[model samples]
Target: MSGPPAAPVSGLRALPAPDDGWKMLLRKEVLRFWRVAFQTIAAPVLTAVLYLLIFGHVLEGRVQVYPGVGYVAFLVPGLVMMSVLQNAFANSASSLVQSKIMGNLVFQLLTPLSSWNWFVAYVGAAVARGLLVGLGVYLVTLLYAPPRAAAPLWVLAFALLGAGMMAVLGLLAGLWADKFDQMAMFQNFIVMPMTFLAGVFYSIHTLPGIWQALSHLNPFFYMIDGFRHGFFGASDVSPWLSLAVAGGSFALLSALALHLLKTGYKLRN
Candidate 1:
């Protein structure tokens, strides 16, 4: 009898042609919110709109920020940025923590994809959601308080940078947190307080001297201040300094996120 034919090689099949796992993961993350547009997208937009309506009504005539810029108009960009930053972070941190809690993360860890791929997929998806949410808030707010673009480039730059920074921070939070409570603590205890104190509702200059100096220490203030400058052509500080702080924070968080993934700090566990 003829000997058995040679067995086919296995576990080394040219890596299956390097499938588009990253793209697929990205698409899946995008679709995750799209499928539930009401919760993920509409809710935030509506919330921001409500804030515009309530505060705009109360403060519109009573307060004025920059010369020639109405209070409502002044508030729009800050709200938009706030919504973007918060939701962008929520997207990634929630996704990661949920995956870990539900035991779905193991499926991701089992894949041949590298840490960089994971980083791109998750962060890209978070940024995309953030931009979409920011756009939505802007469009809705226009109905109540239309604002002129004093520096469109600044608007674009700060929006992208703020969203990216928060996205990276979300990644780090997700990697570090073992549960939703911990993530919530990160958001409520840290992110929320910082954003609220960042002059989202008022000018930092209006605060007392001590508060004004304290505001400078909060990086979120620079983000909001810089974004507001985009609408008024004026700000309390240099736009360049804001850019440096926001960009620097993003770089630091990004490096930390990559390092965590590479070292399998919490992700591998």
Candidate 2:
């Protein structure tokens, strides 16, 4: 005697594929920022514009990082890349911390999604927001002084790699931080200081010998330097070197973030 007949496959709804999990999470994360574009998107663009106007006006004639490139023109790419890195970091870091504080992260934990899904979804959303803000800054700054992209490919490459690296770093920060102040400390003391020192407003070559060497040690320097190279086709270091440093930093951070996610560090607690 057989048990009750098996349910008809056609009558039952199919479960979503594994890939769908990440996709749905990605969509949610993306919407989270897009819905608050006024704050997440517009505010950053305006801040970048203010930087351009203030610095470009004061230093336009006095400071020239690259020959034949005006100071305002030289400043545009740096500002754009800076916006990209900061916002990318903010997106994932804030999302994770907020979810944890509001007690919604458990909902995600209850899903069948793996650690990789969380990383991809969070990082992907970050990259989206970063690129969008970067694009906005670039466009608005163009109104001040148009920076040429002699190697547009380099601009695209470094933007993607830099944004990805920062996103992963932000994810790591998020996983480690139990509260908002910790995240703020990470950003304020670490991310913000590094970005400001990364040749955003001046060339490393102009620095004294010791400072120049110190600048070279900063990974954020490579990102801004390489991105500026795309504009002027000139840089303090070879773009190849910048690419290696940025790429390697990204890989290392990604591994650490994945390991933390797998262990559910601070997340499961």
Q: Count the backbone clashes (under 3 Å) in each candidate.
A: 0, 0
Q: 1-269 in candidate 2: lDDT tens per residue?
A: 87998864221122333657889999999999999999999999999999999999999899877778889998899999999999999999999999999999988877877777888899999999999999999998878886588999999999999999999999988988889999999999999999999999999888999999899889999999999999889999999999999999999999888877766788867
lDDT of each: 0.87, 0.91
**After superposition, candidate 2 runs with Cα above 4 Å error:** 1-19
Q: How accurate is candidate 1 locally (lDDT)?
A: 0.87
Best by TM-score: 2
TM-score, one value per model = 0.91, 0.93
Question: lDDT at 200 for candidate 2?
Answer: 95
- What is the C-alpha lDDT profile of model 1 across 1-269, one tens digit per residue? 99999975322122332677878888888888789889999999999999888999888888977887788988898899999899989999989999999999888777766677788888998999999999999988878766678899999999999999998899899988999999999999999999989999999889999999999999999988899888888988999999999999889889888777776777656
Q: In model 2, which residue pairs have backbone atoms overlapping below 3 Å?
A: none
